[model samples]
Target chain A: MESLAAVDARLHRELQSRYEALVPVLRHGTQLGGKRLRPALLLLSGAAMHADRTAKNPLTTEESATTEDHVVMATVVEMVHTATLIHDDVLDKATTRRHVPTINARWNDDTSILLGDYLFAQSFYLAATLPSTLACRLVGQAAQKVCEGELRQVLGRDWLDIDEETYLDIIRGKTAELTRVSCQIGADLSGGDEGQVEAFARFGNDLGIAFQIADDFLDLWGDDDNVGKTLGTDLQQGKITLPLIRLLRHDDNAVAMAALDALRLPPEDRLGRVMPLLRKSDAAEYTRKVAESYRRSAIEAISGFAPSSALESLKTIADFAVDRRF
Target chain B: MESLAAVDARLHRELQSRYEALVPVLRHGTQLGGKRLRPALLLLSGAAMHADRTAKNPLTTEESATTEDHVVMATVVEMVHTATLIHDDVLDKATTRRHVPTINARWNDDTSILLGDYLFAQSFYLAATLPSTLACRLVGQAAQKVCEGELRQVLGRDWLDIDEETYLDIIRGKTAELTRVSCQIGADLSGGDEGQVEAFARFGNDLGIAFQIADDFLDLWGDDDNVGKTLGTDLQQGKITLPLIRLLRHDDNAVAMAALDALRLPPEDRLGRVMPLLRKSDAAEYTRKVAESYRRSAIEAISGFAPSSALESLKTIADFAVDRRF
Candidate 1:
């Protein structure tokens, strides 16, 4: 938690710009209260790796002093996530996020776009401060995947024949890739071996997928107050997430046709018409089962590591990814 | 010219995406042929530095073999430029660029935003491939400034009292900063000493300012057929460029007020209303004189370097920055 606090402080510092006009907008964009799940995954990954290594061989004083680097990497990942959220808000046209007005809502699309871009550049600037180019390279690759995923989703809008595989691919890039890279950076920076780093990456990837699946479920069926943001945007925007994809693939031809018809309605009425159908089907249950499976895999990915609070935290996060109502 | 060709090939290679859907969009975004001015600045800076050094001491084979690195850096700067243009088109709502439809016009705003982001990430990814983090840091810093500048311009929309100093600051961040870093990366990567690198940066900064000023003039006065993109969007978008800023500062209050009233007209009429008033004043000549001064300074920035074709090219570019109609 203290390390997370450090990450928050570093994030604030990173958002500071010589162009004073951007600072408030950056702060508003970043300070929207999310779970900070990526940063937590990163810090917990680093701590778990450090603990596993320490149990076998004591770390040098220099090795032990990498908390600052961990914080920096954590800040970098958080910035990437925040930047995506800003741009995503512009695309989604959703006004509120985490019960607060988004950058696009408060300012405009141009502001949101430029703010996202500024955060991205600043993240690389922070990563480049590290001794190696590894963080910059990994973050770059991950961010590229994030954009690709989002682009796929945008392009796939109104795609009636969209399948589960395509949905998974979309979430993998837009959501999971950053989390995977967060864990990768954390574990590798803490001196984890290739196998351990790979394990952490899998853990992050599974967790991210599970998180997105759970989010898809929430968008369809969760409470607005609990979710703290607009719901049903996925269906409204013609995004065929896991629940809807499952609903579409239902064995009942009439039910599938009904779902398709509901989606074809105007954005305003589509969510209302589709919700009742989704509630009647096993789509929600199916989505939950898929997310839980990923959660289990995420836990199993790190099960081989030495038992420690950090390792337990990783396991808890995997559970939280699916179990959280929001 | 061969190096520029190499830079183009490298750029094409860099725009390739694993996501099949993104490849066409990325290509379309990057291939909207501009002057390739930033790449030229970078390559010329590298060549000029190399020539200056080689004149004193015959370079080793390894030293002479950095052409690939120069091309990569050149590609990096050009990608950054193209990314900004993509996002700018969205903000400006420009339908066409380089006599072709902009990504925003062909696709949508969401596509433009994501594609710009993807290009930015890919630029960093390419920059990370180099041996040092210098390119990454400089590019990051420049990009941050660019976003800041654009943000300032967006927030300053229709700001009637915006001063020339404020206009300069905005352009410095939005336009000049990236060019400055392109030359810095080129000179630095080519082993230019601190002083030489700083000199090249100054050269780029001045050239960039002059280039932006000329662009402003063209938006106001040049033929649309010659400029090759939608012109007058600045006034339409309430963007207060140098010419209008000068017009606003005319000795006669009535003329300044008329310019202000012209700006306040409907977006469709603002450009037409402001054009004649601008022509009647000394604003156009004032803008040209200011741009020409910066062009002179850009040429003067590199006068100390050994005279070579590359050096001459840099001077020629400085002249072109102010002289070209487009």
Candidate 2:
């Protein structure tokens, strides 16, 4: 808790000075009520790996110094996440996010767009402070994948022909890529072996995919009061997620056509009609099952690590990520 | 010319496989007949610095290998410029740019925004591939400044209280910063001396500021056919550029008030009403003088360099950047 607070404080301090005019918008975006999942994954994975190494030998000065590096990297990850959220609000025309007025809504689209770019630049600048350029390279590639995934989502709006594979690919790029990079960097910074690094990368990817699946599920069916953000946005925006994709192919396309018809109606009418059909067609159940499989794989990947608190936390995170409740 | 063509070809080759759907928009943005000034500055400065070093000592294997690094850095700089253009179109609601339909106009704001992000990520990825992290750091900071400059511009729209210093600061961030980094990286990668690197950076900065002033000039007063893009967009969008800022303060605020009033009119009538006042108030002349001074400063910054072909070309570029005709 102390380390996390320090990380958040660093974020606030750095952004406050980075652009004085943007401090308010930056604060609004960064201080939003996020779970900070990516940074937590990075810190925990790094600390766990370091602890394992130190068990064999006393903690080296250089290794101990990485406590500072972890905070920087964690801040970078959160900045990246916040940047996406700002742009996502603009793309979705979202008025409120995290129970606060969005940057786009409070200011305008132009400010939101440019502020997002500012945060991205800030993230890259912070990431470059690491000893190796590997983090920058990985994070850059992940950011590219996230943008490409978003482009695909925007281009494919209201798309009916998208299959399960394509949907999985989109989510992988949009969500899984960043989480995978986060874990990979964590392992790399901790001097984890190549196999450990690879396992954590896969773990983060599988867990991220499962998390996004659960999010898509919650967007329609979950309690808005619990979610703390807008619900039914996917349907209102004609976004085709896993649930919709599954419902599309159910019962020889009958329910699929009905689902499509329901999407075309007004938001209230559409959700009312689609809710019962989603339950009856097993789409929600199917989505949850897929998430469960990914979660199981995420847990299995970390089974090779030495039993430790971080490894245990990783296990809990996999389950917590896909759990039905918030 | 051959080197620039190679750079463009490399850009196309890289983006073609990056994202299939994005290739078209990428081509549209990158191949829109830009002057290729930033990359040219990078390549010229690099080659010149390299030539000077080779003269002192026989080229080592590593020294000879920067041909690839130069190309990569040049590509990265151009990618940054292209990304900004894509986003600028969205912010401006521009339908055309560089005599072609803009990404925002051809597709939509969402695609343009995401594609711009893709270009930015691509730039960073390419930058990180360089052996030194300096390019990444400099370019990231430059990109941040560019966003800050843009935010200031958006926020300053239709305002009449801006001073000359603030206006210059805005252009410095919006325009000069990237070019300055471009030249700095070029010299840095080529192993230039501290003096030589600083000279090129200043030269790039001055030249970039002049270029932007000329662009602002063209936006209001140049022939639409010669400029090959939509004109009067800044005025229409209430952007207060150098000429407008100058005119606003001229003649004890009389012409300034008239200029402000003219800006409130429709696009077609506004240009007609403001053009004569701009000329009468000497704001146009004042802007040209400012641009000319920067051009001279740019040339002066490079005066210390040996009488090499690249140095001579740099001098010519200073003049060409601020030339009245495109």
User: Proportion of native contacts found in each model?
Assistant: 0.75, 0.61
Interface RMSD values, listed in order for every candidate:
1.0, 1.3
DockQ of each: 0.79, 0.69
Judge the docking of candidate 1 as incorrect, acceptable, medium or high.
Answer: medium
Query: How close is every model to the real structure, measured as TM-score?
Result: 0.96, 0.95
lDDT of 1 at A3: 88
- Candidate 2 per-residue C-alpha lDDT over A1-326 given as tens digits, one digit per residue, 9 for 90 to 100: 46778788988887874446666777787866379899888887887677667765564524552478888888888888888888898999998876888888899999989988988887888888877788889889999999989998787744777899989999999999989888888877888889989988999999999999999999988888888876788887778889888887887678778887887788667778888888888887898899999999998987866667777887888899999663
Task: Output the lDDT of residue A59, model 2.
Answer: 47
Query: Clashing residue pairs, candidate 2?
Result: none
In lDDT terms, how accurate is model 1? 0.87
Per-chain TM-score (chain B), model 2: 0.93
lDDT of each: 0.87, 0.83
Candidate 1 chain B, run of 10 with poorest lDDT:
B57-66
| DockQ of candidate 2 against the true complex | 0.69
- Best TM-score among the predictions, by candidate number: 1
Local error of candidate 2 at residue A293 (angstroms): 1.1
